[model samples]
Target chain A: MSRVDVGALVDEARAGRPLAVARLISLVEDESPHLRAVAEALSPHVGRARVLGLTGPPGVGKSTSTSMLVSAFRARDLRVGVLAVDPSSPFSGGALLGDRIRLHDHTTDPAVFIRSMATRGQLGGLATATPQALRVLDAAGFDVVLVETVGVGQSEVDIVSLADTTVVLLAPGMGDGIQAAKAGILEVADVFVVNKADRDGADTTVRDLRHMISLGRRELGPSWRQPIVRTVATSGSGAEDLVTALADHHAWLVSTGALGRRRAARARAEIEAVALRELRARWGGVRASERLDRLAERVAAGALDPYAAADELVG
Target chain B: MSRVDVGALVDEARAGRPLAVARLISLVEDESPHLRAVAEALSPHVGRARVLGLTGPPGVGKSTSTSMLVSAFRARDLRVGVLAVDPSSPFSGGALLGDRIRLHDHTTDPAVFIRSMATRGQLGGLATATPQALRVLDAAGFDVVLVETVGVGQSEVDIVSLADTTVVLLAPGMGDGIQAAKAGILEVADVFVVNKADRDGADTTVRDLRHMISLGRRELGPSWRQPIVRTVATSGSGAEDLVTALADHHAWLVSTGALGRRRAARARAEIEAVALRELRARWGGVRASERLDRLAERVAAGALDPYAAADELVG
Candidate 1:
């Protein structure tokens, strides 16, 4: 950590060098010991980027929609960076490079950068790595950083917390609309995209989403209403409308002061995650492991409960 | 915390009184201040019950399967308890009382107990409450405690980690086979139950699951071979086979020393969770929040990154 030259990385990053940005992100991903020194150097240059999150079930055209959105953003002369968080395919190991292939369309453009990241082991680590990567992109002068996650579980909730506007995508004929409601997507979606809108039952999917949102609004009253947009992402139709909806949400977030609040909450959570990791690192020792083993054995033997065991260990 | 009379509660629980068991579980659900004392009081009487988790998507007949399992277990004169964790209907609050109605058939029998718990306020709290409630039932002399949760997202993963044997249920034509593979149920399930086996496309669902599972195993080798059991929980048609599969898995776990390892892992996780909760409680103060706001302000203003802010705060 101490041996790395942080000033050079920051200067090159601010000079619009993607290599510096990529290097910084890799340090974060690798949990490099010098992460703090790099952060300290880049901190002054971060936060210019507007974050947009797109998440949905697999095969919902997430990559297609993301590629389309990148084009739309580029048309406005905005520099963009994309972080695709996906699990490494068990067979080929990061072999599901679908997003990367779609993103290859922009490889020659200096204004765009796209990187594919694995979940890296567990849910908790993803939360820690993603923000730092976004910071690297922001510091490197990207006007927007789009985070796209395969929205299946709780980690999708984490992704939503990072975005100023989070779009939860769905498609027709999959019964995903109902699954969305069941998974509490009704709470997280800032903008809903019924991708592949040309497909049969697209209208039904949109109607079902609108119905659920309205019902949810009545219970959780007086909020910015989530707008459902129809899009045929592969054809790039309706991309403008989706972008406009996202822009409107961003504007709403800024004006309502929720943007600051969400940022502060995110900061709070990030601090807690770091603190927990730090504590675990410090708490790792033979003494702790031996005590944990004894307590686990006792708990296993029905001689103590976990809470009591934790109390004794922490004490 | 010390004000509660935990000794009396434990005395009643040891005497096989249902009221005491119900009260202890309520203490857990409410996170009553006396939780540790209750855990301490009941610790020596625990570890005798077999904990089984039945989870699947909505409408996959988890409740029916659980009910069938309870009857199957009770036929041998073993007492049974049920803990049903469902999302709170924003309108009526934990109103998914479907399990309650389904379990009415056993209410007249003294050997059966059923309770429904909501996710309550936070995800972490449910993780805390569930194990304690299970402990209460275990100490109350129930030979089997079945935990049934809707396998939709992160909370379901938490539920899976607590069980000695996890049964992930699915049905034929709802596309749950695809959903199951998508949700990573292929990894957590000890036994797969394709309920409503009388329905059309049951064979296809079974075949698809088997195929996906084989592919996964080829990539990630060695462990318990998850047995797929088709069952019509409505008529109890494959209930015995499902029971036998479960018993065989349990026996395998015991013979291979997996039971101790799984229990130890569960205890280790529980201890960490409790320790984190304690850390948060101790870290709670105006001082922490003020520091958070100051660091958040710097981060928001682009003068500091989140990792740096976290480091400054935690350090």
Candidate 2:
């Protein structure tokens, strides 16, 4: 965590050294004391990577789709960085061995880097850590950074805010149409991908999605209509179509000046999260504060209301 | 919102008036300006109701199971309050009409009250609002409050923390063993309910769960082992067993002194959340801050880092 070591790691990461990139990301994930220094050092080299987000429910072939998309991006000679985020798991770093195994095809390629993140049991940990890790990959000069999160909860939705374009994947016969609507995925999706298209009821899934989209059509005035693409990710079928769809969405974002807006929004959120974390630290945190313990006891004992207790503590 | 009205509402709610309880919950949901008055008014009658949490992934007959449990509790003549929290939906208050329809049997019962809560599109809205609503129900003299949340994300897990006992439901043929592990449900569940037990793969599901539980056995010393119960919720079969399991767990919690610890922990979290919200309001919030906007612009444009910007804003 020394300043010299941090500077050297950033320099090496900027030069595309995988080990250095991994080290920087580990520092971010661990929430090291030197995070501000690391962020400051990596600042200049960021804002260059195109971030694409992919999310879907369990058993939806999100990993396979990510691998297929990686190959497609690589074929276009883009250095890709993949962040496989599993918010449901409390274990972080290398715990998602299955995902790493599935994505082993590019492990030996110097241009490709993959990492898996878990919750680590910290409240709002992924929401804070993911952005910093994304900055590390961005600083490492990856041309396209793909963030793949298991879409089980709000954490994935929060992570998707960091992406320039977000692709929401769904598979057939999972009753995913209602789930997509329920999870509020339709509002955030830039491109709809009906993966596992070879399965039974694929057409029904697609048609149902189309109907849902039509029912909640985006308003006019530079609005980009979300297009649905079908793919058998296991066989890499229709990957080219997905790539084209992504490119078209990216083009629309730039043409409509939405990309900058989205990035600014992301930055705002990141700054707010960090600021709140700092304020919490200053208050000795909820766990460490004796005053909080006393207030909580009173609240639990019905001697005081939580709001009044909070006021006394904050005041 | 006046102090007089809040006092009258609290009096009425304490008298078991359902309309008064619902109005107070609506005020909490809306983040009403008079929330402090409402909290203060409801303070004396709070901390009496036993809170039970029910959560599971979709298609596991959660609504049916909930209905069955409600009937069982009511058979004992215990006044019950039900809170159906849906974090995925942006709409709040009465939007979950389907759930209401499924729970129609208890609508006319004077001893039963049911409510539905959605995200309302506010960050941490449920985390803050739910406890207040729970306080309302607790003060309204309900013997027990059942908090049922759709287990789609971490938000449900957070809500489960408020309960004295949490029941996690799973069904057969859904590959839910791995899913339950992935979603960290194993760590939170006080009891596991294998609903739809008449399904083809129910035995396998139960065996797999047993194996997983054995592998991660809890530590000794006043530990309460989580029990698994099989149920066909559609037919109300095994409802009595589920009730007995819940009662056993509740009694264990009381005898082991874990209930107080849990409530204290919940209160600590609640206070911290409220304090943080107050701090954010003081800083003009993330969206409204001009300083945040300028800092975000610089970070998004690669001229500054998010951590440094956060420090500046916080300072």
Candidate 3:
């Protein structure tokens, strides 16, 4: 389709047309020829949604926890949209159980929209189309949009950068306790939840987690006191408390005037990431990488050093 | 140091100077002012190393398995380098235990080099600086490089694109068996390993794994037989078979001319990802995102559509 049609789709979507919103997101996610036009059309309905990212190691019961959280918010009469990232099977080359079935409770609920996405080999922790899909949810008038990551470590951390609020979940006795101290999850966690607290070693994991917080204090002032909560998700125990904690965190963000800053940071990251993708694509079309590849080859062969090659590429 | 002196570090590293290599890697990982020069200088020794990736869910004993594999390779007199990428903690702002502490047995070995990197908040499955660090490792004359990704579900598959061979590990009775299959790990695995074979239900897991493989037989071709080797890494059981399987896979790559294709594909992906990052950084610096943000505000208020906003930004 021509760029003009994309523009029209965004405009229509903004006028409360679901199809328009879907089409706009597809364009933006794929960066098709009409993406710019589509984005322009949908831009008007975007900013009010509060984006939250729920991420952690897999089997931390993220889906169950997310479903409970959605229920909590919906009880408050909030329109909620859940985006679950279904990981692609590396062996199958396609999506299987690609739907986030844990949220089936909301399947018939008109106010809650849950969509699952396969990574589709996007390589980075996210599907190539994730940002666009999020935009679609945003434009659809959802008051809160929750993005569930596939719990891939490095990329999972990236998800925090995308959200105004990021929740990191951990389980007891995972032996990841020490690794968690290394600071990847801690760095991005606005809130930490000890899921499956019914399991043994929950107390030890919590104690260790608290200790790790003290370690970050070495560099920064008194370290941000990240709130950690415990929950047995299977029985929905402490789910309400978790919701309250979320609300409290949100309140604190507003009270501290950190909400705006966090949102701004996310926007900047998103814009920068998108721009980087655009530039790289353009560079390839221009064949600028050939020289870089040649330099890479030389460095690989041990005939020259990498720094000199990088300098030459920039030159 | 001036550019010329920086070139000496690269030279020294190529000449078996560990300090120079370490420093170069530090510069690359930190994206320091000297990164370009360091990369350029080390370009010649970069591609000689054969890089492999080990990926799977956490608790699959990847670290232990990797250690055993290191021992095996060392026995064969291969110089090895390991890069472990951890997620950045949201709370503390540092990388966690993603470093290979379990592999401490080889720390004193001159033939083995191990380093850990944080995602440094880079989005996607990889550390932002990993590719560059890898280039440095390659340039440093490492015969084999092993990359262990922080298992984050589907995004972990990105490792396959960069490594010559990807070994995906699985544990038995994960209970989330179907979920694992759904993440797409099955597709990218050059070798499927059922780690912790000593655990109960290991056979069932293997049979299930095999059954899953049979479903996609048509797409992968009849020759694509992914051997599901069982292993108990703690005791180093079945590691030998695992190594042999890797060799067999490597041989198949060469026999079928897939190795060349794989390299070509990796090169293309590397350039694209790198280009994207660079472009995004440049655009971010120019404050182009501010305008987008302003447009987003208008869109959020229902005053304009995203498509029109995008067109304005691009135009």
Best candidate (score: lDDT): 2
| Stretches > 4 Å off in candidate 1 | A1-23, A55-68, A84-123, A149-155, A169-183, A194-223, A232-237, B1-23, B55-68, B74-77, B84-123, B148-155, B169-185, B194-224, B232-235, B305-308
lDDT score of residue A274 within candidate 3: 52
> Where is model 2 more than 4 Å wrong at Cα?
A1-4, A87-102, A218-222, A285-288, B1-4, B87-101, B218-222, B285-288
lDDT of 3 by residue, B1-315 (tens): 434477788778767677777788888776677766676666545567878887776566777777788888998998888887633221112323443344557867878877776554555325346777788788788888888864445444565467888887889977454455546667777788898899898999899888988887778898758899999887889989988998898888889988766665565455455544553454446476577677555544556544454445545
Selected candidate, larger lDDT, 1 vs 3: 1
lDDT (Cα, tens digit) per residue for candidate 2, span B177-212: 456554577778899999999989999988988887
TM-score of 1: 0.82
lDDT string for model 1 (A194-260, tens) is: 9999999998998888888878887767779899999999889999999899999999998999888
Instruction: Summing lDDT over every window of 10 consecutive residues in candidate 3 chain A, give the lowest-scoring window.
Output: A88-97
Q: What's the best-to-worst order under lDDT?
A: 2, 1, 3
The candidate scoring highest on TM-score is 2
**In model 1, what lDDT does residue B117 have?**
64
**Predicted candidate 3 versus true structure: per-residue lDDT over A200-243, tens digit per residue:** 99999889888877777676465246778898766778788888
Better of 2 and 3 by DockQ: 2
The interface RMSD for candidate 2 is: 2.8
> Which pairs of residues collide in model 1?
none
Q: For residues A1-315, what per-residue lDDT tens digits would candidate 2 score against the true structure?
A: 454489999989888899999989988878788778899888888888999998877667777788899899999999999887754321223235665576677878889998877653556677788899999999899999999876755566778888999998898887644565545777788899999899898999899888978877744323778899999987899999999999999898899898899999999888887887776776676555988899999988888888888788778
iRMSD for every model: 4.0, 2.8, 4.9
Candidate 2, pairs of clashing residues: none
* Maximum-DockQ candidate: 2
lDDT of 3 at B77: 93
Listed models, DockQ each? 0.36, 0.55, 0.34
